[model samples]
Target: MNLRLRSNAIMAVAEQLVVGITFFVLYGVLIRSVGAEQVGILSLVLVLTSVGQLANIGFGSALLRAIPMHEGRGERHLSIASIETSALCSALFYGGLLLIAYYPFQYLITIQAGPQYAPTIAAMMVPATINVFAMGLGAVSTAGLSSIMRNDLRAVANIVGGILCLAIVFLATPRYGVVAGFWALAAQSIFVLLATWLFLYRQLPGLHLIPRRLNRTVMRDLVKVGYKLQLQSLLVMALEPLSRLLIGHFGTLSQVTYFSMAARYVMQMRGIVYSASQPILSAFSYLRESDPARQQQLYATFSTVIGLAAIAMLSATAAAAPFVGELWIGKREPLFEGFAILQSLGWLAVTVILGSYFNAYSLGFLRYNLGSHVVMAVANLVLGVALGWAFGPWGVVVALTISLVLAGLIMGIGNARFQPHGSRFLSLSNMATLALGCAAVGTAVAGYHFVRGYWPMLASGLASGVIWAAVMLPAFAFHSERGLILNLLRLRIKRRG
Candidate 1:
């Protein structure tokens, strides 16, 4: 990546880290106040409502690719129209559809989470449904900002919204239970939605969300590209929510909380890296037709960085799982530790192999991408159902873990087919180093059982860091992308000096 793109990625990562940490703290408060079962209900509500993204019909995904392409060709009007049209359609169409589906949605909660939780889930959905409406407004705005390389502005909006969510959830949960979480969601959505539009309006001379600005042709093309992307993502995105549902169905509400708890921590922590890497989508889209060789070079470097970061982060987190769980909820639970460790490893597979490929898919490889999702979704459903039925929570997690690794490797094979000669997603030596890092971290985590409290946390974390630096840093130092990164760092340091 170039210096400008790298800096944007860093800002994006900072935004995600702050926002993630804010909500993570709120979840901790919820656990202390309302108990794990209530937290489980909240998790289910959030997961169920996430399906509302279908209302946008993939326009958000399309905007990321289409707007950038349109702008590159100097079609500013088309770019403006695309954003306005997507936002307008999402609010008008998605709101009505979600409200109409409220009862069925409640029924889904009843079946998945339990009947007793249905009433609270219903109460929560009232606000969550409204939040869905606002999402229509926010989605295009968010995408527009990123496509324009204004992630710094988007990050500001997100951080402020997160703080608002933390405040609302903190103040209301003790009195209103998990329902408070939905109210907070509604508030945060509206705030961020407004902030994003205001920012876009300021950045783009003629941007507007008014109906008059919505172009029929832009809307049509957005759906043309978006629905296909949305269709592919619908099943792929269900992996986590479905895993939680399985936990709720076969196990208990508390089990759902445990699973989601671990997942929330890992996903949020990893979001920093994911958000950091996201600029590649815009960068790739910008260069897809214009510069194939440069695009390949960027992809190779990014893929390596993603893998190394995933290993370093996930391995350290897995080793410190017990400590994290204790600190997160004010107590230690073995299940939380197991869930964190398992999920860390699972997401590491995703981040390392499949990280930038989804963004690459936006460069027009949906057929290959769709095939990978099919492979993953099928593996998840088959293994998840069979194992979940046999062994309970552990079975569900193990199923997810295996499905991720299996599908990711398959995707890696497909991604390689498109690569330039002598470029690989993961080199054999780096792969070996990654394997060694995992093994070292696993050993450290295993040894944590012999110790207790903060000692294990510190020791395991330090040991993982040491192992990563010794093994992984050398790989980075010798890799092809090292020059780009080192040069960027040196430029920044030189400027400071």
Candidate 2:
């Protein structure tokens, strides 16, 4: 990647990390003040709102893919018109869904979560739903900006909006409770929308914020590309809510709190991977036409980095779960339960990171096959629900883990056979390194469990880190893109100096 893109990726990851930590702190406060049940209700509310993204109808990804191609082909007017039209359509679609489902959503919440949550849920629903609409609009602007290589502006907007959202949630949630958080989210969404629009307008002088017509031609093209994308979106959107709902039904709201907390931590780690890889996906798309060899090199570098980083983070999380959990939640058992869940689901993180790398490669090359994505989505939902029913929250995670592994294997095989011939596949050496990494993680977890105390956990973590660096770093540096990795480090060091 070029310096500008690399910097943008770093900024995006840093913003997400900061925002994630801020939310984590806020969640800790909410749990401490209002208790886990209230937090559980809040989690459910957030999940429902996330599911609202399904109303986007895959326009977000469609915009991302389409805007770049249109600009590349010098069809600037078409790109701008499509963005405006998609934004308008998304807002209308989501708004209408909210209106129709308002009463049904309320009834569902009351029946599942109980009467105590009804007022808060009712109060938050409108703003949260509005937030979804704002997010849809923001997606278009963000995609346009990114496609034009202005990702830095998008990162800045997100950071600023995140800070504002954190402040709102911090001040309002304590006094006004869960409803305040939803309003804060809505505010954050509007901030991002305005920021992205401002940056986008500056970047593209000819861009139109309002379309003169509906542009049926653009809409038809987007829909043709988006139908399969929307199915994937629906599957992704439904996973979390379904898992949480099952926990509520099969276990309890309290279990939802535990599971959501663990899942949040895992998701944040996954977010790091996503933020870092996203820019590369855009680069890959450009390289596909200009430099196929460079595209392959970038893919290998990105996949290696993603895999190694995920292993390190998840291992450390597992090793230090006791100390971190006690510190964050002020209770040992529930947090430990969350850790156990993480332990069982740790490999799932690696699989997801790898899967994302493959998907991005495929999308960039315009060779993405929807069949595997569809299968994985369906399998995940079925397995998640069935496993949750059979063995509770842990089972849901296990099901997800299995589904992800299966998907990864299937995709990996397909990539090896059908993707460009020279594209790197996981070799025996890489597999061996991964196995050793897993063993190191297991050692860390075991050491922490047997030794106990903060110091022991710290020691275990340090030892695991050392082992990973010693074994995996050398393996990657020697076996993969050594020059690229060395150059990246040198650049960072030079910048620091």
User: TM-score for every candidate vs. truth?
Assistant: 0.91, 0.87
Compared with the true structure, model 1 gives a TM-score of 0.91
Position 369, candidate 2: lDDT: 38
lDDT, residue 422, model 1: 34
Show model 2 residue runs off by greater than 4 Å: 1-3, 210-213, 290-297, 300-305, 316-320, 334-369, 421-423, 454-484, 487-497
Q: What lDDT does each candidate get?
A: 0.75, 0.66
Per-residue CA lDDT of candidate 1, range 332-431, in tens?
A: 7888989988888877777776444744465576666667677777888888889999999899999888877776676677766655443344567567
- Counting clashing residue pairs in each candidate, in order, gives 0, 0
Best by TM-score: 1
- For residues 1-497, write the lDDT of model 2, one tens digit per residue: 23245675787688678767867876787888788888888888787577677777777677766775665455788878777777777777877888887778778887889987788888878887778778877877887776666777887888788788878878887789867777887888899998998888777767665634467888888777676677666765666677778778877888888777777776676677677666655565555545567656566566555655555555555545555665667766554445344533544443434534444444643223355566666777888788877887778767766665665565555555434433333556556656766666566555545555545545645654555456445555665534544554333211110
lDDT of 2 at 448: 49
lDDT of 2: 0.66
